[model samples]
Target: MAGIRFSQLIDNFITTIERYGSTVLQPEISSSRPANIRVITSEQVTDCKIFLWTITPGGGGPGVRPESERRIQMTNISGMPLWPGVRTLLGGWSQEFGVYAFWDARRHTKFSFRSPSLQVDANTLETAGTTGIATQFRPTKEGEEVVVAVAPGSLLWYVQNGLPLHNSQDDAAFVVDLAAASPEEERNFLDSAQSEIESARRYDLVETMRAFRDASFRPAVLQAYSYKCAVCNCDLKLVDAAHIVPITHPTSTDEVTNGIALCRLHHGAYDNALLGVKSDCQIVINPNMTNRLHEIGLDSGLEEFKSRLPDVIRVPASIEARPTPDRLRLGLKLRGWPEEQIA
Candidate 1:
């Protein structure tokens, strides 16, 4: 715990799972001084739950070398629902293992949350424990879920788990926006979101919203695409935003459904093909692009992306939010070219 930090390990594990998509072929658990290890996965959030556990001595497994290291992993078995008193007790013992119970909303049960025991300032703990705790259990469907992310540094059990967690409201926050919220109510929402973020040490709500914005764009593009790449149908690390339009001009093709996000090298190679995502959201590779193949590392990826393009097309924004086909066309034509305005 003192050597490397548990949160660091957990964060690495989370990242691995996110990238590999559960059920890693085999993880390389290092036996370095800190007994470091890493497992990679490419799963999205909804793919699978990674349940980690230490091989316990009682289970005829290696015991944690009290002075050196401990083991923890993602799991499905949830710890008891923690109350303020419960959090305090657990917090004291958490250093040994950064642990908390994660509610797997999908299963309607705790997915198992654990951390290497992040020590909180007494003042901060007092505020965090009681402040964010909803007096009553809001229905699962209601807006009541905590997305916790550890700070990457500042003495964590592991450095990797340090990413900031942003808990987005499930519509209630926006509902308040729609309703005639009095100044008091508006102030409360902002203050509450702000307080939880500061005490928990997270980026502001705007940051969280930005993440959604980026993801929406990616999702929108892929919705019209196949799960695999549209060019080569290679579903590996090749499906990503190709920006039928460049990202240089955020106004033009940054939104979801605007451009397909291609993976690895296809994006860079796309411009050569005169491959344009029509303002109509159609894939339009110039007739000439048919010539360049292996030179761009897209012999397989490009072909795969082509046929699968229409399938993965993302849900475009509302008519009003969508970029006009003309701009999209102009944007692609000038992409990577001298930034010239459309005539």
Candidate 2:
């Protein structure tokens, strides 16, 4: 029985996301069998795991039966060590769905689906019934082989929606509908997702949601600003999607209206209160920094920043992507800038 190569699976995954206008960043293949791959989001934070298990015929259960009832057999792969960083079977929705573990029988470490009657002993881990985790993978028959073909839009939605622990088939269909939806309808869907994240009771879930939100937010801001720094217009590797109101603030949001594209230096400056953008889109440098310019070396950099001053910063052509006055005012307030200075 021949099996699919890990590389081919990755190529398929890449093709799926690219079709939906998303790029896979820093893909690291850690294993061949059971296909373990790690990816970084656009934010350059959070390691996402993409693990695939090939379901073979005639495995664990007595099945001279239907194709749908076939179980995925866990074969012992000796000397396989655990890979570092976060490992999730599908997307690490929750403990109830999947878990990170080391296979005692095979000495292999990876993410495994957790069934309701799952048993974990010192030597082996076994499941009593059909696990819900398999539904997300949604293995499909390709040629004569059964392989997991993850839905394209669902892959993107998983990163944006914090891997909601639910029926992935329905979620996949929902995302497909949204892809063809009107702008207002899409916005409403994103808003509803944000509301759910905000109302989440678990701290870990909130953090996961925020990380996922940033994954989408960074790219949106960069695109709105034409992938250039709004302050210095540096379009190189230095640009970063900076929050107008820092993420720690209670009222902070991941919306493009609450974000700005800036180079590393200006981003640091904006966060440190050394630079600011006003509601009228004017770029302002703090007087205190200007008062003692020579004291802080990097005079050339400071001059460059000053040269752009009294200047209206670049804004997104789309009204929705442009920074809102209320968010800018709140951000400035958080920076301790006086109202008179902003006015």
Best by lDDT: 2
After superposition, candidate 2 runs with Cα above 4 Å error: 1-5, 11-80, 83-201, 292-300, 308-310
lDDT of 1 by residue, 1-343 (tens): 2333435544555553334222333244433212223323221212222232331111124553332222233332344233331111111112332332222233322433453221122222222233221111123342354322122111121112212221333432342132233445545656555465443332343333333334335544554454345545556644665554554554543555356545444555555644555555555555445554555564665566566555223433455434456666666666532232222
RMSD of candidates 1 onward, in order:
14.7, 11.1
lDDT of each: 0.37, 0.51
* RMSD versus native structure for model 1: 14.7
lDDT tens digits, residue span 1-343, model 2: 2434446655666565444334455445554543444343334333444543333333345555443333333333322344455433431111221222111211124324332111122111112112111122232321111112223333443433434322222233243243234445544555555345433423333343345456567768988988889988887556778999988786787789999998887888888788889888888877765665657664567776676654878898899899998888888888888677776
Q: What's the CA error at residue 55 for candidate 2, in Å? A: 8.2
True-vs-predicted CA distance for residue 222, candidate 2, Å: 2.6
TM-scores for candidates 1 onward, in order: 0.36, 0.54
lDDT of 1 at 45: 17
Model 1: weakest 10-residue lDDT segment is: 85-94
